[model samples]
Target: MRRQRPIRLQHGTSLHAIVLATAMTFSGASALQAREAGSAETSDTQVRLPENAEIQLAPVLVEGQERSAGQYTATVFTGAEIEDLGLFNSEDVLRMTPGVNINSSGGTNLSSVFIRGVGSMYLSDVTDFMVPMVIDGAPINARHISLGTLDVDRMEILKGPQGTLSGPWGLAGAVDITTRKPTRTFEGYGRAEYGEQGQALLEAAIGGPLTDTLSGRLAVRYSQSEHWVTNDADGAPMANPSNFALRGQIFWDGKQGTTALVTVEHEDVNALPNLLVLMPYGRKPSVDLTPGLYDDVGKSLNRYALEVNHDLASSRITSISSYMNASNMEIAAYDRKIMQAQSGYPSEFWNQDNGRESFFTQDLRLSSLPGDTITWAAGLFFQHMDASYDTPRNTYGYTSPRFRDFKSNVYAIYGDVTYPVTSALRLTLGLRQNWSSTDYDASFWRGGVGSFDSRAMSESATTGRAMLSYDLTPGTVLHARYARGFAPGGYNMYAAQIADGEPFGGATNDMIEIGFASESEDKTFALTGAAYVNWVSNNHLLAYDSGTYVSSVVNADTRSQGFELQGRWRVGGGLELAAGLSYVDARITSSVFGPSDGDILSGNLVPDVSPWSALVSASYETALPPFLGLSSPMLKSIASYSYVGPRPANPQNSLDLAAYHKLDIHVGVAQDKTEIYVRASNLLDDMYDLYGYAVPAANMAYGGMARGRTFVAGISHRF
Candidate 1:
């Protein structure tokens, strides 16, 4: 885990004296290392962990190859770990990582993936994510990062600001997911599952050789579930979810040291989770919704991509081209009683939104090959996006419609170089130059207010990072870094007036991080600790009007500081212990507060973020009896405990969520290619808020709590 600077670890220049550095370099590949430790040919400068180690670090990709094990900064999950943990989506996997938290406002909006207590914090139909999620060398909005994950080879979550190499929406960091490629040998697998509330899932995949130099893989998954909270309005299951996805990939191993891959994918999702229960007062939790209301949302996506990697005498060249399209529709209801701490009259309103978006991106890069003393990678990137939105609403029996045509373009050059100062010391420098433009035209009826068109917004920013790493011992390392990240600002189409869009400004963040990673000589113990601080200005924040049910975007200044510690221990026998802790202090440093608009004050904790989070998990494996009638039978079990501190629910500090903890246990029995397991969720049956917000003037706090106590049984097999 990586964290803000602890002020104790420094090299050369004073940590606080870190200037706007230049020439930071990187070539990421997080695959496991088969070579001995301290090998110069190793692409991963982090820790080289043993196979049985507990915690995983982010991958370091060098010359199209992956190197795994520990990174002083970042986290990683290999394909095997994904299956073992039964991780199905971004939330599932990220929950196990330290210093990462997932918060949602509920609905079709994408969940905010917060790192070190910093995130977009608010989600609406038209909002864009501040973090970049890379899939198969293609950069898309953080949309699919939480949608689904299938046939993935590895996942790497780099903490803090990763603006230099992966440039789009780098205000936070980056999440890179590499899908499994077709192999020369035939291999396939199937899985089926059933859970509480009529939950069911089916998934399958197959890949094999199609020709002497070509191979193909195809995978599909379908899942559906009933809402945990029943809708008393119509005695129906509201917030039900149904999702389907398909992917086909082809890989070619051609001429001398050359490889190419092509991928096509499609996905459809339907669900809107803004459902809330009816709890009139300080009574017991009543899991029933208001009368005459429901939530519905649908999203569809299609993606096509091509990637080529060619090896040169001393370097590797990569070219990637990708195009994707997505469409979303949402018809959801809002309750005026939301966040009402005291019982009051029930008020209801509903709105609908329909939109389509398309994105095209191209990237070319050259990097050092293995065995090179100096590691470096440079790339040129270009991206174009076109989107259209149609939002029609009916609040208090009044009709309002809004339309927007939006376009965005980006161009950039970024590179990183890593040089070993000596056999035990290293310095890295990375730099990125980016230019972006956003244009949008809006047409609408803002109820009593008039509508207007949007203005053009263009901005240029230079981002870079400098890292200094020194070996404390052969198995220990200390590192400190300085990084800057940026995101272009744009019009908030959902705004009621043109003033909110005419001269919007972008957001920028600068950070300093220091941490260390250490491994036991015998490769049985590993630990990582980090600390970091961020300085941000002109950042977008969610502004809501409880009366109009309109959510706006406003610019604000904030500061976030945090620290993390994670470790793994492999005791004797087949038992392992893993634990991690994170603490973030995020607050609004300065902002123009408005009573009816943003409605937030300085010194308030950023809404929806918890200051303290912790995780503890244990795993064990043992042989099964011969009476099972299967060869090499094994039984495995894992138990996890997570704790989240109380968090402010809204900007006004009117609503606060109580502290909560969740315990889960999973046990499985395996024989050859097949495994059967049962998982218990929320073993403690703890009920807590999923999303919360303050009413315009309700002066009361209210929100929905997650369902308690559920179980799922599943079977997986590989063929």
Candidate 2:
């Protein structure tokens, strides 16, 4: 079907300016309040309110803690806050997190998450360079981490090296998501929504008692959307995406000290590849070209997990076991007609990639109960994964087929201890030892002949952390820490093009950081800030060799330093405000494959590393007067703005991405058991590039475009 052009809304420029100015003004007011409150010396007991008039706020927890008083440098978002922001998926949630960036080439399943300018530059069945993602205590693959957050209880983003606690694959950071558990009371909610471009959504969840000692919960969601882009060649829709997911969970509270929980989930996704528009000399095209063909890419996943906990006299023991299976298939036009348009190629080529992967993991931990002077935890972890990829291509009467198989095993032991040296001072120490091995096998067939080769490699590393924290005053704390992280290396599947039995070496990072956190006596204002410097040795870098149509992984040295600030304020009346700002300086210190062998590229900005980013948001809620013989209803509205600075697109720092800004707004009304809302995103309908890659041989370049203005309306009911 032909897609219609979006209507450009007016008054966006004025609204944007107003939002920025208002945020700045409120920020200044909050800072002044902080200063006034800090002038007087007060005991920590003075911050507590009277028992009768005390107001309870949502608790701040990070991945299983009752509160995040002084554990680590992190950010926590509750489910209610996520819903208020209208962020229902992983992509949107990560984009709003501080110091994080996400880029999707063409499909949500093919997205990459970068933290502190560290992530994989290419996607493959055997690559594991991105930030690790954990859902319900089970680790998930990077390609399959775009699951919906509809039923999440809380999300915790731990910044910097977490190797000692999360094992490998956390060299940059880690994201842990906890799903809502079954409730003892009977309750459920259902919602439906309609939006532009033929978008429709349906979601429902229910949880209640099934038996005396057993409770169960089930949730399902489905969504479909028409293409937002138009194809000029045939005047048809360019891309359409849809997905369905279902989850079931059961909980058993057995004896006094025993508890168990089990969960199973399945998800399926089908979508068209991202729209690719050719650009020459970094200029947008007046008109988009037509693709020679179109095909759908599909992915399916199944996951299962079991967790058990037993309380001892002075400690608790826990165990977690998980399994996952996933498959993906794609068939599409490889050239997208860019070759024909720019290089006069006779015809476009076709390509296919079919792959599958399986994962098994187990973790055991024992932790001492809370103590007056000391607390400690120790754990053992194990994981095994296998993956296979097959690729077939036909270009101008030449056919080539390739296949690769990969297997990996990981083992680790870690421990951490915290002790209070004084009433206001605390110290912590942690260490981890990891051992990993990988085996890779590949084969290629051409002219009715094939050859095969196999290679294996193993590595070991020890990483640790040391920290000190002190309370400056009531509701204020200052901390400093030193940490180390590691990421295991592996072989490139395209063994035919590289040296025999050669593999990339593991990478390591060392960091030193200082930070502070403070909250107002009334809990109406909060602020957290951090500054850190990191040096990485043997940094893994992916480079494309245009001459050979192959990609290679290499090691180099790099450095990154940055500071981040986040704040929240609850002004008088019904107004609330939040804001975040980050600045980073990341560069390559040395590399061997530069303009010449052993050339130094010191001071060159790293690819995809934005130097500056900021976010500001406001929300208001109040009761409305009675109308139409109905009781008072509540009205709520929220607005948010985000800015991302420009960055280098390649290693040479030749091509650059332009800075961009986005705005989102939501308004709703609620009465008793019913609620209605309307949401608008990208209010300005701004057009910008999310990512760009060059095809030098075809004298062409293509990129992914940011989404334009979109609107949605929805209503829901609760019992």
lDDT of 1: 0.66
Q: Compose the digit string of candidate 2's lDDT tens values, residues 1-719.
A: 12112112111234556466455324321111121110012123111212321111111221111111235576566665565455667676777665776666555455666677666554433647446777777777566555677677667676777755433337777676778888788877788889997778898889988998888999888888866656556666665678798999999988688889999998877764544555531222222333424445778888999988888998778788999888877653434455556557634454566678898999887876544246666889998989887675545333568778889998999987777888888788888998999998887777878877788889999988888888888677888889888878887654333242268788788888888878777777777788988888877665555334455566777788898888876674566666778888888887554421122255667666788977676666566888765585766566667777777655545456666677677677777666788878776565555566554444345556656778999887765
- Candidate with top TM-score is 2
Report per-prediction Cα RMSD to one decimal.
Answer: 9.0, 6.8
Worst 10 residues of 2 by lDDT: 31-40
- Compared with the true structure, all predictions reach lDDT values of 0.66, 0.66
How accurate locally is residue 384 in candidate 2, as Cα lDDT from 0 to 100? 95
Residue pairs whose backbone atoms clash in candidate 2: none
lDDT of 2 at 483: 86
For model 1, residues 597-690, the per-residue Cα lDDT tens digits are 3456778787767889876666666667765577667665666666677777655555666666666666777776687889777666665566
